[model samples]
Target chain A: MIEIKELIKNYGEVRAVDRISCQIAQGECVGLLGLNGAGKTTLLRILACLLTPTSGTVTVDGHDVVRQPEQVRRLIGYLPEEPPLYLEMRVADFLAFVAGIRGVPRMDTGGRVQQALQRCQLEHMAGERIETLSYGYRKRVGIAQAIVHNPPLVILDEPIAGLDPAQIVEMRELIRALRGEHTLVLSSHILAEISQTCDRLLVLQRGRLVGSGTEEEIAGSSGREFRLEVLLRGQRALVEQALGQVEDIDERQLEQRGPDELLLRVVSSQDVRAQLAAQLVGAGLQLLELRRQRDQLEEVFLKLTGSKEGAS
Target chain B: MREVGLLARREFVAFFRSAQGYVIAALYLAMVGLDFNLRVLGGGAKFSSEVVSGFFFELSGFTMFFSVFISMGLIARERETGTMPLLSTSPLSDAHIVMGKYLGALLFLLLITAATIYMPMLIMVHGKVSAGHLLAGYLGVLLLGGATLAVGTFGSAVTRSQIVAVFVSLGIGTPLVLFWLLGRYADRPLNDVFSYLAIHNLHFSPFRSGKVHLRDIVYYFSVIGFFLFAATRMLESRRWR
Candidate 1:
């Protein structure tokens, strides 16, 4: 549904979005994983036709963002990091206004606004003035306005940025509900939020696409180290020698946990537990408590970006 | 046009929804009433035409100020409140958005201009006045208000702060009105150029006297068009910036 090629956006001396390229499929929910200053917002803005790429081209459904912005804009709905809202307007009225400008047929605008309100779960607050609503509801209104026109591709920049835990959960469900019907592309520095909400992940680090795929695929991509704790019925020195024989084992620390048992912690470039088990059996050792230690999203993100800052 | 209308209607209604809009309108009406009671009536019995002319002449100044007040927030406030993305990402062109905002402010100005009709209508009850004259004077008021509002809209587009927008508007317009004074002291061709460019004196005088010259009409539209176009250009530049 979206194609971006070598998109570079520069502001005089500062290159906000460097040579980044990625394709998002129709009906696929793709999350752009990056910390602040990782060019997530700049990239989304370029796709939404709000910013022109300095050197590359971005197209939504076949229309070029630069050459045919109005056409591309018609197919995509965008929510910026901060929800663009008029506080004085009522929830329903504001959605209607957005729908009107988005070129929803005049006769269909009401129905569209109603559908948006229902989908965003804002029906209870439809008549409430936006200024009176809380920040979370305002965010929901922002989502409502974007989808009010029922665009095929929805680009949300940091959709769950400033929400509380409960609000984040609701937002996740709301974004997930929009998955199959509309091609969803959302960006977030939080690994768990992006991983749980999106089907595919594109990890951006310092304005470059470092990895792209599902969580497990990215975990197993390359250069990822797996930590394993194996309890063995052997001497510490013997367990260390056996683990040393296993290939891809980067480091090993063996400790005597019991009379005939040793707790061997092995850090390998890959999942070398099987190799270690085979080698340990050949060395006359019983393997116990053998497992790979890695959190699903955090491990994959740390492996791809190699940054501890976005662990949140 | 439909999009412009939709935007304009929203803007016009906003004036009723907010206390600031009503406060400004009340203050303007109070001042107009006071000026009518003091300067026009207290001066003594005068020609009905003079009273009418005097009203339009002074009302012209207030019209300029009113336009500035109404238009200061046109584009600037949207930027300030972070709502510009709603308009910027839409399928509409910059010209349409600018025109929509201008028309919305103009609608409010027109309503405020309409409210002052009672002051002119009182002339009909007390003395003889031509309907053509009232129409001509009102047309001039609309044109002057429109021209000033367009300039203010341009100012609002160039800045994100409404106060800065106000000063920028007055900075552009105050000189145009004052150019008429500069024309009186200048020599030959320069004087002619300055007088021709003066938004008020040479252009608006003919309309105040119930004479609708096509030249003055074109001048008002040209001012309105040029500024609105400039505002649209500013938006286009900022959108990609």
Candidate 2:
């Protein structure tokens, strides 16, 4: 378990992390969602013991980060934005070295390295020097080094930041495979990556945690109406009449596509897509198409982080 | 201790795998060899003891210069390549990381210094030279190298650029080297203090002449200890930044 209480970190006159507090239960995979200067890196660095907090306390599994950093470090594996790798070493040798320094038993170092190699699917690149590998391969090597010691918690920052679409998918699967074995804390600015991979999301804005919960929970907390785009093959007056009958529909806008086709934008306090479709069909209208608008998570994130761009 | 050993081993292997280490070693050996051939051998009618003493004198100067090159990249390169976070976030203390890097650089220094043995052995073959003088001279070179390397390690810890690290070390080391010249113009106790603090003039002269004073050994070791402690403290202070 990880417990952070009113943690604060300052750089000169600027407060990078301001009085943030949270608790992560065992075996939970959480994503930290934020913008560029949202204090995500600073918070992770403090948890990793790379930087000391200016105030408050962070404890990992009963060990205080400031007072017993080494003990805390022993329990967690951290992969920074840029992977901390030695390019001169071969992949296998590098994993072995990390395992050794991370306190893997001498007799089991080779076995542990082999397991990491397999876990990261770098078994074929084991003999290759890290400098010769491509960026995607290097990221795999970074993940391999982090988990070589079988740490209880693994913290990854921007794990899929620069990968291609295919690589991102592969990386997502790999992260998902690490779910049961270790508690994970991953940070990213990409909303879909966080929504797809993480069980819960902690949103930050300008150095403060703005909100945290599951996708639905966060959307519910935002108190925003659910939006749907309805395409109907009927009269606009009948569509408006059907929308008025629905109790949850707060607002509706109609755009005439043609003589028989109309587009309706419906906002409701709850998910009323099924009810809206049934009402339109029952009111002597043909439902041509009905689709929910963009993901509510994006809306919740943008509103929370105060960004105009939806997601990238 | 085991963590220190592991870090040291990694750094030691890194030195051999990188081009900078080989280039530095090769250039140092070539320059030292050229000096030995031109000055020690080319000068005519020199006694074997004088040749040995001159050899130590020239080698100590080269050791000081090359130690700066060897140690300048110790921590600075890690920062440049973004690998320092691995060590900082590990379960090891700052002291262990500094000590391990120092030991690894010192070991490489020892290897290069030991390779210069044939120069002294050549003198032993052609002329009469005392084994005691040979032992004393190598000890002086190694100790001086250790001190200069510690200064360079501190320099590396203070900055991220290897070039800046070298300049920082030279900035700190050049003053001590010139302290002997400064002592000549000073008066009374000031002159005495400068003479005592001089890195080469008063401190290393005895070892060059086949005399191993306990005070000189203590001075070199104290220098090594002081700079290494400073390097460790610099590393610790970076967490605040």
Candidate 3:
């Protein structure tokens, strides 16, 4: 339900967000993938109406962000990188306060707060002061406040940035659960970190929209040729000898995995898994596994950004 | 308007929820008490009316000082701790946020002012003081305190550092309160303007003397309104910046 056209935001001499544009359909879970300084936060802030675009138009539904900010604000729930929490306030009270400010009707504020509490699984800590909670719980509270008003669009900037592995898994589940209820937009520096949680990805590099689509689509758009990996039970010579007959095998690597098992990586012009599997079994070799390379996207992402993996 | 009240109540209650409130209260009461014992009530056999008036006159200075302390964190701390986005992204206008914050700090200032009533009652215990004198003096202190708090809010709005906010507010308010002195040495129309702009002497004196003038009332409110409006504009400017 959001449309942005050629959005640009400048911080004086620094162009934080360049002329970039994208649309977020209703109930679409979109991840803004980028490394540090990729303008993810700046772009999200523009969509959240916390910052006005330097040029071009951004509208939520039919309301322009600059001209009709209050209406735009009413339609959004934004969670900044740092959880906007008042440490002295209790969990439920903080959510209630957020609900009030977010324009939830006073009569329904209690119920709304409780619903948000339950959504974030913070009902048990409802009465606890914010200062007494751990960082993970605080992030949950941040999410709770964002959903308290039940806005149509929920913008979470770096939602999983500071979480431990277990917390990240829980947060992933939490974000996944929110997909059908609202249009979700979150940012992360890693490609695989949020790819599984989002329906589509908007890859940014140095203030530009470099790539946008699903994982396979992004991988395909990256112009990567066909590739596959296979595991087999045989001597290297016999495996290589069997695969030497395949005409489409442009390049291949055969590495010994165990005494009898061998690992084979193949790059080819066409599908050769069926032919390769038959060749292995025909040569009196046991075929253990054959599939597409799983980490191709990671390589594609690194190639696109031209930066080392996990640089940010 | 309803949002203003809700936000104000939240901020007002926040003061007592932490140790900051009690520390400010304790320090303020002690400072005012020490000044009252040594300066207003200790010196000589002054008339009860003069003593109460002098108490208010001295109390106004402390009120302004403490008002700066109270309001320094109103918005600055929010920005420092990353909570400003919650307010900035909300449907509430900047004016509403500023008013909510101003009213909250004002309520706390008034509460602290209320706590100082014991000092006045101490005057009442032995000396004969008119209730009108006491009330009018208190009205002046509250207005002066509130006006300074608005200045502090403006200061807080412009910067993210509370220390800078305190200094900026003091830097702003010190000159306004000292305008009467500037008027004393300056010439012509400038003198009249400077004297009128004086926040304390020219405006607050009447209220301290148990007489409420519409002009002084207008002046205090104008200061409050002008600064609060400036603060709201500062807050709104953030979206563009």
Candidate 4:
């Protein structure tokens, strides 16, 4: 439903979106994963026709975002990080207004508004002024407004950013319920949230596309590295010696969590936990806990983005 | 057109729902009432035409001032509150958004202007006044208010701060309001240019006296068109920004 070709958006001296290209198919819930300043919002705004590209082109549903912005706008709904809400308006009135402005036929506006209210679970609060609602309800109203006209694509920028934990779960379910019915593109800095909700991940860093694929595809393509955590009742030097014996070991670090307990981190090309455990037993070191740690998507993200912080 | 209507309705209704709108309307009515008592009624027995003319004169000034306050937040407040993306991303064109906002403010201004009809009606009871004159006077106030609101809309489009929008509008509006003063010092051609350019003196004076000159009507319409078109262009430029 969307295709971007070498899109570049520069704000004076700062290049907010570099020459990046990606395509999103219809009905795919894609997550834009990046830290702060990743240009995710800028890219999404370009797709929504809210911002014109500095160069290249972005098309939605076969319409150029720059040349046929109105057509492109008709095909997509967008919710920015901060929900665009009129506080004094009732939820239903706001949705009806949105529906009307978004080109929903006048005869269908009431039905569309009701469907949106039901979908976002905002029926009970339809008559309540937006200012009287809680933040979570307000965000739901924002989503309701976006989807009121039943656009083919919905772009949400950090939909769960400021929500409480319970709100986040509800929002996640709400977003999940949108899949298959509409092509969804959401941006987030949270790794787990994006991974859990999206069909594919587009990892960006410093205004560039660092990686794009399923989590496993990204991990495998980036060369899977096995990281292991070992708890051993042995001297730190002895644990290091055991790890040194493993031929696949690329790097090893031993930290003493207790007087006689050592927590070891070993990075290797393959799982050598069994071999390391044998070596530890052969060396007369008591192995308390030895398990192969699965390579986390977080590590892959950090490696691709070259960031030390796990969560952006 | 439907989108414009919907947006306009929302904006118009919003004015009544918010305290700032009431405050602006109340302050405007109070000023008009005070001016009516102090200037029109207080100064001994004046001719009914003069009283109505004086009312329009005071109204024109207040319309200019209050129109700025009413329009300063039209676009700027949307941006400040992060509601601009809703309109910007909608299928509606930039012209539609600008026109809708303009119409909403114009409607509210007209309502406020209409509320002052009692003052003119009072003149009818105490003295004889032509209905045609009253009609012409109200039409003039509407035109002036429309033009001022358009200028203020342009001002709102240029900034994101309501305070800045007010100053920017005043900056653009003050010169036109002061053109009559400039006309006094200039000679011949320059004086004529200043006189013609003056927003109120030559253009609005005729309407104040119950005379509708075609040239004056055209000037007000021209001001309205030029500023509204400017506001539309300002809105469209946001895509690039």
Candidate 5:
């Protein structure tokens, strides 16, 4: 379990993290989504015990980060954006070294190192120097080091940044594999990345928690209507004219796929898919596809960040 | 204690793996070898004691000079390369990290300084050498090296550039060396104080002459202790930044 209360971090005069509070339960995977300079890195660093918060408190598994730093460090593992590693050391040697520093017992270190290597799929490159490996392999080594001691809580900052497409898929799979074993907190500016891997999202804007919930909750809190896309067997003009009759649609688009196939997309404040299907059939058109299109992750990110840009 | 051993092992292995460590060793050996030939052998000194004393005197110079390079990157390189965060975030305390790093650099210094023993032994073949004299001279060099390396550790901890670390260590060391001269010109009480505080004069002279004074050993340890304490404080204060 992790809890942060009124966490504040300041860099000179700039408030990097401004009095933010959050709680994460055991075995939960939470994603921190934010824009550039949004205090995500600062918050993560503070949680990792790499940087001290200017005020407030953070505790991991009942250990206070400030008062019991050694205990907190033993319970948590951190992977910074650049993946702190000694390039000269071989992958296996580096992981073993980290495991030692992470306070893993002497008798169990070898098995722990092996487990981390196998989990990250780094067994093949275990003997290779980190500097000699490709970027993807190096990242795997980074993740391996973080988990080599099997800390209960893992905090990853921008783990997917600068990774190739294939490597991204590999990393996502690795994160998913950790679901049962560790409570993970990962931060990213990329929305799609968070939505794909994280169980919940904490959206921050200008050093403030603007939203925190599941995808549906965030979308609902945005005060924006869901989009409904419908396909009907009728003239596009008649369906377009009928959609225009609906009073609450913010916008509507009608497209003709064939002589009888009409595609209707409507942005409204409410769920009108059922009413639209009935209206299409009552108007002598065969109803086909009638479903509300969930807002894209990108659109949700924009709404969360764009709304704060003007006021902040 | 195990953490200390692990960190020290890591640092010591790094020195051997990089060409820079061998280069520093080679440079110190070349200087000591040239000095033994030119200053000790070239001088028309018949007594083995004179030759041994000359060798110890010259070796101290190399020890002091090379100690700067040996400890120059102890903490500064980590700060520059951003590896300090890795150590800082570990479960170890600042004191453990500082002590481990200091031990690593000190061990490397001992290895390089010990390698020069052959030159003094070669003198032993031609002229009779006292085991007591040899041990005393080597101890002096180690003490001087330890003090200078501690100062360098302080320099590294206080800055992020190895170049600046070297300059700062030298800047602090040179003044202590000159304090011997200041002692000569000062009045009674001030003269006594300055002479006692002088790094090379009062503290290092007895060892070069085959005399192991308890005061000299205590002085070197005190200097090392003071600087290491400063380095530890500097490391701890960085958490606030």
Candidate 6:
């Protein structure tokens, strides 16, 4: 379990991490979402005991970070955005070194190193020097080193950055496997990755917490809204004219599907699909498909951040 | 202490596995060997004790100079390559990390120091020299190497660039070597102070002359302690900033 109260960090004149309070229960997977300079890295560094908080207090497994840092560090495993690796060390040797420095028993060091290698799916490359590995492999080695000591809390900062599609899938599986073994806190600017991997998220904007919740909860809590997907058997001119008459629709995108049928994407202030269907029918146009896009979390995210994008 | 040992072993292994250690070792040995043959062996000498003392004296300067090169990259290189965060976030204390890197550099320095034993042994075979003098002279080199390496470790801790660390270490070490000259130019209280504080002339001269003083041992140990303490403070302050 981790509890952080009023965690604040200031770098010279600029406040990097403002006073923020959060808690992570044991076995929870939490995602910290932020853009550049949103204090995610700073927060992770504080949790990992790499940096001390300016004023607030953080505790992990009942040990205070400031008062009992060794104890806190013993309970936490941290993987920074850039993995700290010695290019000259082999994978197995590096993991064993990390395990030893982290106070693993001498006799059990090999077993722990093996376990971490297996967990990160690097069993084949255990003897290879870190300098020879690819970026994805190095990242796996980084994660293996972090978790080799079997700490209760694991923190990964941008674990999936710069990974290919297949590597990303494998990494997602690897993170999921760590669910019961440790409480995981990961920070990423990729919203889709967080929405898929984490059970909950804490969103930061300019060093302040703008939102925090599950994806559905964040989407629902923002406000009432609906996204409309309309297929009309009419020309683009008639479709645009019909969408203009619909009240409470904020934006619309009309694409001519064929000579007659058109596809219309409507961002509405409320659910007006029934009224739109009736109006399209009354205007002598066949309403082919009129349905609300279910679970528009991306829309909610963009709305929270004040952005708009259409189907391309 | 066990953690420190483990870290030290890792660091030492890194030194050998990469080209940096071998390169430094080869270059230092070449320089020391060339200097020994040209200045001590090729040149005329009066006594065997003077010849051995000359060998130890010459090696001390090289060891001191090379110690900085060995240790300047110990921590700062890790910081530059973004690897210090790994150690910082580990369960080990800052003291463990600093001491481990220090010992790693010192052990490598000692290894290179031991390699020079052949040059002294060659002298012992042909020349008449006492065992105690040889032991005392080697100890002097080790102590001096420890002091210089500690200064380099402190330099590594202060900055993120190994080049900058080399400059900082040399800046601190060169003045101590030149203090003997300053002692010559001054008078009264200041003159005595500078003379006593000179790293080589005051403290190391007795060892080079086949005499071991407890005060010199204490002075070398103090130099190591003072710089290591400063390094630890630099690490702690960096966390706050």
DockQ of each: 0.65, 0.71, 0.78, 0.74, 0.57, 0.71
The Cα error of candidate 2 at residue B76, in Å, is 0.8
Q: Is candidate 2 or candidate 5 better by TM-score?
A: 2
Model 2 Cα displacement at B152 (Å)?
0.2
Worst 10 residues of 3 chain B by lDDT: B117-126
lDDT of 4: 0.90
Clash totals in order: 0, 0, 0, 0, 0, 0
User: Fnat per model, in the order given?
Assistant: 0.69, 0.69, 0.81, 0.91, 0.44, 0.85
lDDT of 6 at A224: 45
lDDT of 1: 0.87
Native-referenced Cα lDDT, model 5: 0.86
Off by over 4 Å in 6: A224-299, A305-312
Clashes of 3: 0
What lDDT tens digits, residue by residue, belong to model 5 across residues A165-202? 99999999999998879999999988878878998999
Q: Candidate 4 on A200-248: residue-level lDDT in tens?
A: 9998887888889987677776776877888888676776676667798
Model 4 lDDT, residue A260, Cα: 76
Tens digit per residue, CA lDDT, model 2, A142-187 = 9898899999999999999899999999999999999989999999
lDDT of 1 at B154: 96
Q: Evaluate all candidate structures by whole-model CA lDDT and list the values in order.
A: 0.87, 0.90, 0.90, 0.90, 0.86, 0.87
Per TM-score, the best of the predicted structures is 3
Model 2 chain B poorest 10 in a row by lDDT: B194-203
**lDDT minimum window of 10 residues, candidate 3 chain A:** A303-312
Predicted structure 2, TM vs. truth: 0.92
> Which 10 consecutive positions of candidate 6 chain B have the poorest summed lDDT?
B40-49
